[model samples]
Target: MYYLPKELFFPSVSLAHSSGIIALGGDLSPERLQLAYKSGIFPWFEDGEPITWWSPNPRMVLFLDELIVSKSMRNILNRNVLKVTFNQNFRDVISNCQEVKREGQNGTWITNDMIEAYCKLHELGIAKSVEVWQDEELVGGLYGVDLGHVFCGESMFSLVSNASKVAFIALVEKLRTENYKLLDCQVYNSHLESLGCREIDREEFIEILKVEKVDS
Candidate 1:
């Protein structure tokens, strides 16, 4: 139960305390944010309270080459019904993700400060987005930080059935082509597992990430 220092990061594997609470009371400044992601920790706090950093015990990740694209999903992908793009209309993508409703939650966890902080990370070339559009309308998308050779996925949303899946598939395929070794899902859910994300121990994650050099 220690507060996160200004622009300082605790050990990713340590995680520091119960509730996966790595640290508390840090500004969402760009430098601190970038350092946090690079160390495999990220900020996750609701509005009004100081930013809380976390690095869970079991880290969720995916190896791009190992992604399981089911025959059914491959067929859906082959259809190419949805158009995907990168870094285009980030604000819309993030806003939509924030507004999307999840089970047992009335609203989003992506606060205004969180949005702006990630936007700054985007401007700095660390954060990236994938957008799905149909007939010039935003239907779904995802965003995250490209830390080292790993992509730390933050959030995703879909307006139409399978739209988010489409966007995610497109992004994963692109990462594979780009030679990115890993995709950090951060947390796990049925949807992510269905998309091929899996949980790895913190030490395993840190080891793999350490071997990966953060591309400038």
Candidate 2:
């Protein structure tokens, strides 16, 4: 649990300390935040709490071509009850994610500062949102950053039952259409597992990331 300076570049921090938490107590500036994601690091903190950076050890990710679409999920896909759109409503999606309360999680880590930071990322065309629309209203959505062919999924929320699932399927379809190579899920969870996310070592993730074309 060490602190990092705002002026530090991508090379300043070491990946070997992904578990030790190389940074803590820093402002979520657009440049710092952008650089953080590019280096596979992210911030997570509660309301009124210090900005805490983290890079988990055993990361969760899914190769776009390797998603395990179960038979049941395939049936859900066939129904096509909902339609999906990219960057349709980023503000709404993030707000929803922040408001949707879970039983155990202490309040939301998606604080006001977090919102503004991701909004800045969205403005730069780095962070994106995928909204699931049913008829005329938004039911579910997810947001993340698009780095080259990889989509680093951040958060998702559902207003209606099964809406999140719809959004996810739509996201995969969009990724396929766009020829995406992977979706970095950050961490593992049963919910993501249901949606076909799997685990890959952090080293492996860095290896794949290293080969990506750097944005000019």
Candidate 3:
């Protein structure tokens, strides 16, 4: 792996490992994060670890048209049990994502620095949050950076069962309406797979990123 410099740049995705780690040891400044997402790279490291950048092979992504919403989830959406909003409480959404304990994970990757950096991006309209509210209380949500044609998801949290799913479905519907080309989940998980996210060659993903955007 390569060591990052003070400048907001990364090595070629072709140089990344099989696991997609492209480089290490960089600060999570907003500029770096912006450039990273724009170039199809992202930072993912646990607290106290050196900032690790990744542009994984077999990139996991969801095209808006390929989204899968189960019949059960469709029924739930029809029931209108939750209200979904955009950018209503980005900080709260990220804080909840940071606090939620997930299976097999002892700690969160959404460190304080990441929270601050993403919040800064949110302030500049480069990051966004999808909030799921239940009876005026925050129940579930997700946050991510908007890279023109691609929305790079960071993290999500759910206080109740299926709340996060509802938020994700809402976000996908909105993205589709807005004509987004892709939803970059960064890595794969069974949950995302169930939602119709599939892996493509990192080079293929990079080619899409190169041609699908309006601007940074």
- The most accurate candidate by TM-score is 3
Which regions of candidate 2 deviate over 4 angstroms?
10-20, 213-216
Report the lDDT tens digits of candidate 3 across residue range 1-216. Answer: 799878777888888988889999978778888888888899889988999988988899999899999999999999998999999999999999999999999899999998999999999999999999999999999999997788898888999989999999999998888778899998889999999999998988998888775532
TM-score of each: 0.93, 0.89, 0.97
Question: Per-residue lDDT for 142 in model 3?
Answer: 99
Error of 1 at 152 (Å): 0.3
Q: Which lDDT tens digits does candidate 2 get at residues 45-83? A: 788777777777677887766667778767876888777
Greater-TM-score candidate between 1 and 3: 3
Q: Candidate 1 — which residues are off by over 4 angstroms?
A: 213-216
The lDDT, on a scale of 0 to 1, for candidate 1 is: 0.83
Specify the poorest-scoring 10-residue window by lDDT in model 2.
Answer: 11-20
Give per-candidate clash totals: 1, 0, 0
The residue pairs that clash in candidate 2, if any, are none
